[model samples]
Target chain A: MATQASLDNPPQVPSQTSSTGRGFPTGLAVLTGFTGVMLLAASYMVFVYAPMERTLGNVQRIFYFHVASAWAGALAFLVALVAGIVFLINGKMQWDRVGKSSVEVGLMLLTITLTSGPIWGQYAWGNPWPAWDPKLTSAAVTWLSYAAYLMLRQGIDDPRRRARFAAIYVIIAFTSVIFTYVGVRFVEQTIHPHVVGPSASTGEGDFGVSARIGQTLGFSLLTFTAVYATLLAHRLRLENLSERIKQVKSAVLARQG
Target chain B: MTDRVEAETAQSTRRTLKPTPLAQATLAIAWKDLRSELRRRELVAAMLVFALLSLLIFSFALEVDARSRAANAAGILWVTLVFAGTLGLGRSLGRERDQGSLEGVLLAPIDRSALYFGKLIGNFLFMIIVAVIIIGPLSVLFGISLFTPLLPLILLLGILGYAGVGTLVASLAAYTRGREILMPILLLPIALSILIPAVRATRAVLEGAAYSDITIWLNLLLATNVVYIVLAYLLFDFIVSE
Candidate 1:
């Protein structure tokens, strides 16, 4: 349990060097810059380069970022799932950190996918929210599953036990994410567009993709993937720093006693 | 004290008893739970009452036209079963935690997964009992026929998957604060995967859809059961570790 004294009197983070005695890596900086540039270019391609749909017109442009963010969200969860397995096998705290950070990033990206999805859906489906669509319902379920993952983490105070329990949970929760991405496509009743390969012919929002739209979709995916990586790296660093601060605080408490 | 004598005799029997095989150990734990429940009769009774009460509410909540009743039957039954199942799961595990028996169970010579399977079996049986008892009233109240040959098979698979995951999660929640409330929050979303298909399959069965039409859902329910049971087997040890 965290004591009120330690909570109120927090340790100051060293400005120049981390507890590792290192500054930010050049590789991360370069990746950050590259992601920024790619994001700008991807936006240009989405709004300017990709041709407006024959029917959906300008509203169809949301598809590029929508699918890209969803792709990034799924990728982040995949990373967490792998991190969870490794953490359980090796009992490594760093792997636990990676798993936690990835889920946080994944949840953020999923929120974007879910919220932006409804906006486009309002125009494409004439309903901002369609409860019957398997794609949307499963995505909501996936979101709730990960949200519960965070709540589970919050309820446990022991670090190692928390990490172990979280690893077990995140791995189990990945099923919902898989269902959202792949399993729902098998359902014949969903009206959500299946932009990927051959889907059931029953979807109402299905559209034909042209050459430029495909290019922009690909670039947006790359940019969002980069964004996921950048956010995860920064979140991991923050986690590491907070862990160090806890160590220092506990040491100070022992000295005072 | 008589309590000390009981503990001493229990320890003596354990010393005389050799380590049982995994299946035997699992059955012993499951039987212990069943025997205890049989004597007390509270857990299943509460669950049965809850299940029937919800059925009563649903009969009025949905328009009870003969046509709509069949259409609404599947959803109402699953929802009733899941809520009742959650209540039963929480109580079963909460009893172990409250009595400090889980630690004693953990100290046994059996494998951790034996403990998991034991609890799963007990929970599965409770769910089956409540599910069976509810169907009679549900059919009578809704004025529909539900005695199809295949319905029990679907109920078995669905409850297997539900109880498998529910036991694992209830154990997790048992150690936390306000575990009573936390049980449903953590369990329900993951349960959606299982419940949706169960409801769909049941709807098809009720509507007299061909076996061909229902095979997809039945297959999915079986696959989910296999996955959850395997995952629970692999992961249960981590939860029980000191």
Candidate 2:
């Protein structure tokens, strides 16, 4: 019955080959193009159109990309969490693939956020890295948690067990991300600027953005969301191809024996 | 024939009794672990010695003066507990995995949540015992009375939260290749949410803060404990399920 079901719905392999003939799906291709164009437009607006901050000077421009990356990273992890829960509910391999791809992409983007954050800190606060800064600390912890997720995946041998455990783990690990997102409010003394929420700390340069800055920031956020979708779709395809290769390798070995 | 039928009815009634109550099943598993640990005496002894060694190392490393020691005592206490608790959790679960008893426990008729509560209770007891033993030596060394009535209450809540999450993560880590190192890596980040409030509350209690002043920290600790316990209970069956 299982074999018949699988045969009835054959896997759809994309035909629009990118030089190597392992074709990128048309939807992914369109997404890649859209993301690239939007990213260029966002960068142009951020650098040329947005006004300079009176307090922090030109270096504050990094905030647009930095915050955009952080938002994208958070959204990616949120997708992973949803995928993980769905995988747990139905035991679907596709959901596992989505979860794994999103985590990898999210980790990459979060690493960018963590690095850019310190540079912004150095320009704004005279210190490159401030210990006990709540958002930064929480981000570090979230990064470590998902990094451990990847490491956990590496340690398990059986693919099914690995998928199951990873799905469960990502669901739990996402709490750290939630905590990082809102934990700053509950924490007593954070130096991170409260851009969206009410300012809790008495730190300098925690002001609201002007109209032009908001426009640029909004554009950047939208562009990065597209970028995240593009990356996730490509990563999912890579996972599918790898899985197919593994199946083919085993089949060939059986035939040879 | 009537006597035989009555006897048969009694046998069927006995056989049809519900499986052990949740609380009883939980305690039974906990008791089994406790009795086994009592026989071996390895987990608690190792945890105590490690905690004391951590204390000694902290004193030497910090070059803590009497005044400094009093000020930093809460941080010292929690750091010690976190490491020692991690050690004890890893060893306890590692033994179960190695002995193949985890499988036996899983195969038993009780619900997986019962097994979880059992291990949680066992772990919480071991942590409290280690904390109790260390508090005395720490008090003598630091020259501050660490034995406030509020202290144990805080420790209980903190360790309950810790063990609740730690047991689940330890079980997950036990199945991994780097089983020994993975528990702390997986556990410490989650435990921080609990430990932060715990350390703050412990400090407030030790410093004799007003009841109102310490209430928030205590509430945070209680909230985290409840969250972790519920999360572990919900997710553990999925984790251990084949």
Candidate 3:
């Protein structure tokens, strides 16, 4: 029944010759261009438009986007988690595809977080992965768990079962992620203090950001949210199109009978 | 499982012939399953052999001297059972599946939960037998009194929780394509939360720790089992239907 349904509605990949936004001059091109522009503006604001931290100096500025990207990745995973539940409920393949898109974005964003975080860590504070600081390890484990989720799906031939298993894994992975994140603070006293501010730990770490800088950070989050949506839509279309091609080829093969 | 099926057929025949006079079906089903497993012993023998081999491997691999081996013995025992138990579980489910017997059971008039519970009980008892065999040799090897009251209690709870989760996972993995590899891969992480606390509780009990000292660990084990049983109950239908 599922095979027949898949055959009936072939995926629709746009027949465009080049990578473009619905036949426009650019797809990734526009994204890169906007990112370049935002980067330039952000750099200007970061050094000149926003004030620096009194205690940590220039390094604190990295928090504006580092934390933003991490936060965004976490948000994406949450969406993926919820979407996984929805996909399981109705057997909607589209929901599963969207869930995968969010996961990919989350992975990419987490990679950025991991990369940028250490650099920021090196400059501001010394040492990395001091303890089983559940925060850092959880993120890495969440990433690994999802990678394994993909591997699990890859091993299965049946699409419906694959989606179901994948959904179950996401739920399990999401639970672990929460456990890792939420359980960390109580278990260990680490150098990585709460971000919301001045305390016995990284003193005045939160005090550096002014109102204008906070506003700038908010705008950066908004921009990335837009970028996430744009990329998600593009990825989903690509998935839909590939599915169509598969259907078409299978149909053609059947007709060749 | 075979006995249960036989009993079910007998009861159904009586139903067709005599109706309400022969309506005691549930106990007959349970009795059949228990008697068949008691006779065949295939699952128990495999689990026991696999568990002993794990202990042997661990003893050789660790190179821990006599002094430390006793302390590490509890960990070694649990780890061996958890892993080698996978083999027993996969074989147990895969055999039923291969023989087309699973369908017969599914076709029988019984609650799905009854079938699940029957499998769980059978698997749990098999694990306990393996643990008993393991305890004898492990005691000789580690020079620890594993037959002590507390140790048996710990073993029973640990084996119960482990096999409970293991049976459900095995049933699901039976239907998956790459049954052998996928079973362990899927089972290990999801079962990690449960196994950790069980092993921990056992370690605490073995170290002459008071029950109060290990209460949290045991509670964690109990809580995890309850959660997984509920989840497995809800989700087993999906795997069976598939």
Top-DockQ candidate index? 1
Query: What are the per-residue Cα lDDT tens digits for candidate 2 across B36-79?
Result: 89999998999999999998887767765765555578889999
Preferred candidate (TM-score higher): 2 or 3: 2
Candidate 1: true contacts recovered, fraction? 0.53
Candidate 1, chain B, TM-score (2 decimals): 0.93
TM-score of each: 0.92, 0.90, 0.73
Per-residue lDDT of B1-242 in model 3, one digit per residue for the tens?
A: 23444434744553354321112443444455557677987666777777888778776777667566545877788887788678777865677789777776665555556556666766676677777778888887777766666667667776776776677767767767788987787666555555555666677776777777577666656665676677666666665656
DockQ of each: 0.63, 0.49, 0.23
Q: Poorest 10 consecutive residues of model 1 chain B by lDDT?
A: B1-10
iRMS for all predictions? 1.5, 1.7, 2.9
* Runs in model 1 lying further than 4 Å from the true structure: A1-27, A179-181, B1-18
Clashing pairs in 3: A11-A244
Tens digits of per-residue lDDT, candidate 3, A118-233, equal: 77767656764444454666666777766666666677788888777677667766764664465443433455646653344542234545788887777667656655666666
In candidate 1, the residue pairs with backbone N, CA or C atoms under 3 Å apart (3 or more residues apart, or in different chains) clash, namely none
Error of 2 at A219 (Å): 1.1
